[model samples]
Target chain A: MLDSRVLRVFREVFDDEQLAVSDTTSARDVPDWDSLAQVKLVIALEQEFDVRFSTTEIGTWACVGDLKRALRSKLGAA
Target chain B: MSAPAEIRVSLDWGGGEPMIVRWLVADRAPVKRGQAICEIEASKATADIVSPADGILVVVIPDGDVRDQEVVGHIHAVGEALPLSAAAVERGPEPDVEGGTHVPRSLRKAAEIRTLEEGRRGSLPSTVMQQLVVGDLVDRLRDGGASLTALVILAVARALRKHRAFNASASDTGVLLHDAVRIGVALDVEPHGLRVPIVTDADTKTVAEIAGDLQILLYKYMTKTLEPDEIRGATFTLTDLSSFGVAWSVPLLVGRQAAILGLGMIRGADPRDTMLTFSLTFDHRVASGREAALFLSDVRKRISEHMVSNDSGA
Candidate 1:
């Protein structure tokens, strides 16, 4: 469920429909996954999942897998 | 007569500079103390600013970004004249110019102040240009859905990153280097005049992504939804006049910024072998002709390499 929702956020942010964000998905893997996209993704995720990421947690994401873990933790805390 | 209450931005925007997004009502409109007079926004939050006291709103700093405790406007009691003369008190925008009513007056003023006064800003302005041959690349990129403007912008961003001297501002002291590669793009809003919206952190984005960003910004401009933040803060400015068939032009620097690039129309007999003319006007206090030449050479090289990168599927 989280991956499905997270992928939707990516799809909307980059305007790409076929982008399959897997566990190994990183900025290197997705060419358009820059700061702007990340900001949009975070806002969408916070809105859909109703969770918040701290300043420290925001920087720890190196890939989609990292993002999942952070989101999972944040969602659980919420 | 009581003193005119000052309108200030006291909201905490988490270190993000809060500014007057827009006035809710026209200047000099009557309002109660709790009435929302204008909208203010920071990176973190957006809120309507209420009047401090019941009075006639004498807008001083009519619009644009404002610092903390900065007086954007003031509210004076009815029937009481402004402490200062009306002419000296309100710095409202000038009358609309011909074919430029849609454009924000501040933006037009900014363009005038930055471009017209470059020669006398104690900055010895100089220009260096290069004619880049990239007909084949342009044809390929155009067929594959790429904007010439976006391509040039990305190339310029990369060049600025590699050559930080062009990304600096010359001050009374020395050339102050900027950490971020925020490219201010001069967009012709047609009858609205010219607007310089920025694409921030441009060096970190790929050409395709930059195109996508440009698309969104373009849509925002068309819809008149561009924010003040997007229009302010430029490490460097880029203006293109190629559509008009102009050959070469020296783009004036924004404020004390180090350099500005003017792109000319693509020219060549063969569509597959076209050449683009671009000139970079630089602050002589910050960089010399040699440095400007090297920077333009890099921009030219990066632009020409578009084919090779696309061929390699980068």
Candidate 2:
């Protein structure tokens, strides 16, 4: 479920409905996943999941799997 | 028909020494008036040499290291033919040794500076770019009678207070982190060279105060009256290339300083939805990639939060 929402955010950030986002997906996996895109992804994720990320938490994400795990933990805690 | 205008590289005694010249437009190519014809590099600074008239480019000097006030080439009107002297054509590339050719003093100074930077900084710098949504902030600043550059300077200065590593510089003995934040603003004094005047104690200065200082600094730079102390001892540096419509640029790191931030043009169709791209080049030895990214994120967050609060208050 977290993956689905993350994927939706990714699609919105990249404006690519056909982007195949997965657990292993990294910046290199998506052509448009640049630094700017990364920031947009973070903002979109925050708005989508209704969770705020601390600066340290924002820096901890390296891949889609990491994002998924962090979102799951935050959601469970909420 | 009027004689073809002679395009020469004007020397900047106060600018970077011995600038390397690179032609942007090809030789003998038709070019427009005011089109960027070449780029000149001096030390870590670069500037574009624009054509003065619409015409064909007749390169008298090929791309190589050039001194100030050297005649690099000429621009001729369409269908006009200029004779190329054998001596001009035979002028070969720059010789390897200093003794082989008369090297300009500025070029030599630039070389010495390059050697020093390479020797002092053992590791290569890491770069990170972030696209920040700033349409609302730009609007609010305009409404509040504030410049975007002043806002960015304040935001970066505030963030640097939290990340001391970036606000510090490398010394001979060790890393020296300064308590005061002095930010340098890079100005493109075109047809001359780039000049960076420092805004001393930026951390303690209000946005209006910084903007006032920036205006005075820029005025000094334009009039060639800036004191040596005004251009030195910056804890951090910021260059805004947005006026040129540049999307992004990776600015060269200044010696001793740990980081430099470049602000690209803010672009968007809607006034309420514009975004600006910022590129940060930091000395990796001082800060890791994550720290830099987080620092940038914090700066962005602070700017956004400040702007949102302003909007609500207004």
Measured on C-alpha atoms, candidate 1 has an lDDT of 0.74
What TM-score, computed on C-alpha atoms, does each candidate reach? Answer: 0.55, 0.51
User: Model 2's DockQ?
Assistant: 0.01
Residue B174, candidate 1: alpha-carbon lDDT: 90
Give per-residue lDDT, candidate 1, residue A70.
Answer: 87
lDDT of 1 by residue, B76-108 (tens): 899988654333433455556656444434644
lDDT, candidate 1, at B241: 80
lDDT of 2 by residue, B94-176 (tens): 55666655544453344334433542466457789998777656544533434578878988999999999889886555678
Clashing pairs in model 1, backbone N/Cα/C closer than 3 A = B135-B274, B242-B265
Taking every candidate in turn, the Cα RMSD to the unseen true structure, in Å, is 10.7, 19.8
Give the Å shift of residue A23 in candidate 1. Answer: 35
